[model samples]
Every structure is written in structure tokens, then in C-alpha cells.
Target: MSGNDILVTDGLSKRFGDFSAVSDVSLRIQRGTIHALIGPNGAGKTTCFNMLTKFIAPSSGRITFNDRDITAMRPADVARLGLVRSFQISAVFPHLTALENVRIALQRKRGDSFDFWRSKSALEPLNLRALELLDSVGLTSFAYSKAGEISYGRKRALEFATTLAVEPEMMLLDEPMAGMGHEDIDRIAELIRHVSANRTILMVEHNLQVVANLSHRITVLTRGRVLAEGDYRTVSENDEVREAYMGAGHA
Candidate 1:
């Protein structure tokens, strides 16, 4: 792995019985860059992402992060090393207010369990940082609202705030634009761009326009293998990519 690369995968493959989901894939994600994994439906994008995050074990391969082999690490162990998947820590409490939810996450990061029996005053120290996180994601105005009462877009913003509380060095976002209207998509996209200013981001998204606009590098997968890897313009112009998307009845 290059000095600039924060994450690397070698000969990564996954199989279910006789079917291969991801095959001999390798990747080098550079530090502080937005790298996207995109492909048509059933192209193993989710399976590959699951393996990278350690949500599911790979059939065969090696994964290294920050120069340490983490292929066998548990999801929480990998997350503790500063590589976190968004929804992994975004178990937002519906009954809690926005501020409370983020504060709980901050407590978790500090190796403190949320003390439900303790007085609210005890959590005051974490409030400032939690509020800052909420503000960063444009959720400060809703800080006192119950998380379940917020709009879907704002709920997603809440998720971002909670994720930020963990202080992940690299964030893996899966289908961040899924099930969103145009305005929500734009909001989340800007939030992503803002937060990525200081950390590396890897995302799997089907929205080609969002991928083109946000990704510094794009990896295209087709039928369990890498078809291309490059910037938006280069990958967009590749004949194989064109065939994989256009010829296979994908847009």
C-alpha cells in the first residue's frame, strides 16, 4: 500500500455456496479523498461494502486500514480504530431529543455508557460538543425536538450528527441518497461535502450525478469484478463501463 492510501484490499472475494458475490477485487483508497463504489443493481456493491466494514466476513482476502490488517477484526473493533460506517453507530434513539441522541454517542466514544439513572446535569459536559456536531450538520435548530418527530431529511441529518460524535477518521456511507426527494438529496449531499473536508469518505450510491459531483475517485463494478477505476470523466468514457451500464439495461 502507498503511504497516501488509508485503506487497501487485496484479492478480496466472497462466495455463497457456489455463487461468487465479489471476485478477486483489490482497491487502494487514498487518505482524505472521496471514493465511490457504484454499479448496477445486484453487482455486489453491498456485499463488498459489508466486507470492508467487517459487517460480514470475506470468504477470502485481506483488508488493511491505517497499515494494520483488519480482515479478522469485529465491526466494533474496526470502528474503534477510527473506521466507522454511518448506520453502524447511528442507532438513533427515537424517544430521545436530538441533543440527547448525539450526547449519548459522545459518551460512547469516551468509553462511557449512557447513564440513564444519572441526573441530566451529569451529561452537561458533553452537550457543547454534541451541539457543535448538530450545528455542523444543520440540525441545531431541532436540537430540542424528539428525533422521531423530525422530518425525514432532518432525521438523516441527526444520523450524521450522531456519527460525527464518534470522531471517525474514515466514514463509509451506504446509499446516502436513497429514498430521498430532490431537496433532501441536495441537503445531504452538501452535508457530506462539508464533513468530508477533514476526513476521507467512501460511499456506495446509485445516483450517478451525485457520484460524479462528489467523488474524487470512482470504482465501477460489474458482475462481481471491477470494470474500471478513475475519475468521473475517465470512467464515464470507458467502453466497458458504457456497455455495463447502457448495454445491460441500466442507465
Candidate 2:
């Protein structure tokens, strides 16, 4: 692995009985770069994210984060080590106000999430951090709005803010732009670029244009294996990628 690599996988594989979901997938993500994974549906991209984040155990292989072996670590442990993931679906609390949701996440990061007896004013620092997160994601104007009342795009943005409360070193984003309108997509693309400036971002996305625009490097997967790995031009021009897309009727 390169000295600057923040995340690495060697011979990673996952199987459900006789069916292999991911096979011998080795990948390296450099620090402070946006690395994108692109493929057709059911290409095992989500499975790979689950294994890397320790949400699911790999059938075989190894994972390293910050140069430490973490293949078998629990999800919380992995998260605590500064590797955080944002789900494709929003994980925000719909009933809570946007500010409250972020405040809760910040409290969790501070290990005070279970301190329910304390009044809101007592946790001044946590509340301040939560506001900072909301401002960072451009949601401060909606701080008092119920999370469920926000636009779908803004809710997704709120999710990103919650993830930032943990101050991760690296992020695994699953379809960050999913279901967004054109304007929202542009906004999110900008937000992603802003966030990626300080940390490594590894994302799985179906939008080729977004991937081409944002990713410094691209890894194309097919049939649970890597078909190509390189820059936008290289992957776009690759024969294997062309074949994969053509077979999926997306070409």
C-alpha cells in the first residue's frame, strides 16, 4: 500500500453460501482524494462498502485503515476510528427538528448521547457543534424545522451534516446524489467537493456525469470484480467498461 493511502483492501471477498457477492477486490484510496466506484445495479458496490465499514464480515480477505488491520472490527469501532459512512437512504430523525437531529449526533460523538436527563441548555458545547454542522451543510436556516418537513434534498444534506459531527478522516458515501433534482444535484456536488478537500471520500454512484466531474480516480466493477481502475478518461475509454455498460443496456 502507498504511504499516503488511508484505506486499503487486499484480496477482499464476500460470499453467501455458494454465492460470492464480492470477489478478490483489492482497492486503495489515497488521502484527500475523491475516489468513485461505478457499476451497474447489483454489482456488489454496497456489499463492498458494508465489508469495508465492518457492517458485514468478509468471507475472506483483509482490510486496512490508517495502516492498521481492521477486517474484523465492529462497525462502531470502525466508525470511532474516523471512518464513517452515509447511507443511500436518509438516516435522520424525521420527528426531530433539524437542529435537534444534529445536536443528538454531536452528543453521540462526545459519548454523551445517552445523557438524557441533562437539559438542552446544560449541553452548550454540543449544541454549538450541532449548529456549526448545520451551517456547514447550509441548513442553519431550517434549524427549527422538523426534519420530515424539509425537502428531500435538504434532508440528505442534513444527513451529511450529521456524519460531519463525528469529524471523520474518511467517508463512504452511497449514492449521495440519489433522487436529487438538477439544482440539488449541483448543490450536493459542490458540497461534496467542499467536504472532500480535507479528507478522503470513497463513493458509489450511478450517475456517470457526476462521477466524471467529481472523482479524481474511478474504479469500475462488474460481476463482483474490478473491470478497470484509473482516471475518468481511462475508465470512460476502457473496453471492459464499455462492454459492461453495453451488456446492461446503459450504453
Candidate 3:
């Protein structure tokens, strides 16, 4: 990988039986930028995310993160390198308070055996940082609220707090604005912007408006291939991208 890029993929491809879900794709994500991958439904965005996160193996490809090859690394191993993802798949404990949920995630990062409710100094120290993370995501007021009792938007923010606890150098956000009302969307957008100042972000989002607002660069996928890549203004003006969205009834 070039020093300019924190992540690079060459000819990434994935297959399910004989069906090709993603075909020969390449990407270079620069360090300290918000890069977005977008497409109409069935455009292989999820496949690429899975492959990059080490959730699934690509049929043929090479992925390098910060000058290290990661195509063969396991998911946990990749996460240890500071390439972490946060989304619904990252379970938030329902009964745990917002602060406690974040504390658990922090503890997991420490690899300490969970001695639940045990009066140990090891677990107590995490609370301070956990509360700080909650504040970072604008959830300080809900610190004592049960995770399940919090609003959906706040829960998502809590998820982000936990993800941040891991101190990721690169974060893959899964549709951060999905199902959010305008207020939540705006809040999360600002949160994303704030957190992205010193880290790299690669996200797969369907909300074009949010994508336009946050993305430093955008890649458009169609039928499992990259059809266009550039800034939002550039990709939005591309005839092929418009046509692809129109044909998929997304335009």
C-alpha cells in the first residue's frame, strides 16, 4: 500500500457457488478521509464489506491495510490492527445500562475474563473511559438508562461509543443513518464527522444525502462491479451512475 492510503484492495472478487457476488474490484482508501461505497440494491456493496472485514473470504484478491496484507487475516486479528466495524451485528446488551454496555466492550478489548459483578479494580477503571465514550457520542445523559430502554438512535450512538472504545484506526460504519429521523441523522452525521478527524472511515450507506454530506470520496457499484468513483458531485453527474440507479428504480 502507498503511504497515502490506509487500505488498498486489488482485484477483489467473491463467489457463492457459481454466482459471482462481487467481481474483480479494486479500491484505495486514503488515510484520514471519509470514503463511501454506494449502489442500488444488489450491487455487491455488502459483499465487499464482508470481504474487507474478514467476515468472508474473497475468491481472488489482495487487501492491504497500513502496509500489511490482510486478505488472509481473521476478523478478530484484523480488528486488532485497528480496522473495526460497528453496526447492528455488534450486539448491545439489552439489560445493561448505556455506560455498562460500553464498559463491557472496553473490557473485551482488554481480553480479561468476564468476572461479572466481581468487585475487581480491573473492571472499575473502565467506567471512566466508558463514560467518556458515551459523552463523545452525545449519550452522557442516558448513561444510566438501560440499553433497551434508550431510543433507537441513542442505541446506535451507544454502539458507536463501544466501537470507539476499541480505538480503531479505521472504522467501517454499516449504514449509520439507516432508519434514523432527521434529528438523529443530523446528530450522527456530526458525530461521524467529529470522530473522523484523525481516523479513516469506509462506510456503506444508502442515504445519498448523508453520503453527499459526509463522503470525501465515493465509489458507485453496479451488478457487482465498480461503475464509477470520485467525489459525490462527480459520481452524481456521471450518466452511467444515474442510469444504473434509474434501471434499479433507485433514481
Error of 3 at 103 (Å): 1.0
Model 1 lDDT tens row, 1-251: 58899999999999999999999999999999999999888889889999999999999999999999999999989999999886522356889999999997788755756567977787799999999999999888999999989888888889988888888999999888888899988898899998897899999876667788889999998888999999999988898898886465543
Residue lDDT tens for model 3, 17-72: 99999999999999999999998788898889989999999999999999899999
lDDT of each: 0.88, 0.88, 0.88
Q: Arrange candidates, best TM-score first.
A: 2, 1, 3
Model 1 TM-score on a 0 to 1 scale: 0.93
So what's the TM-score on candidate 3? 0.93
Model 1: CA > 4 A from native: 88-91, 114-120, 246-251
Best by TM-score: 2
- What is candidate 2's lDDT per residue for 1-251, written digit by digit as tens? 57999999999999998898899999999999999998888788999988988989999999999999999899998999999999988778999999888876677656746667877786677777788889999998999999999999999889989888888999999989888889999999988998887999999987677888899999988778998999999988787788785355545
For model 3, give the 10-residue run with minimal summed lDDT: 242-251
- Supply the global lDDT for candidate 1: 0.88
Backbone clash tally (model 1)? 0
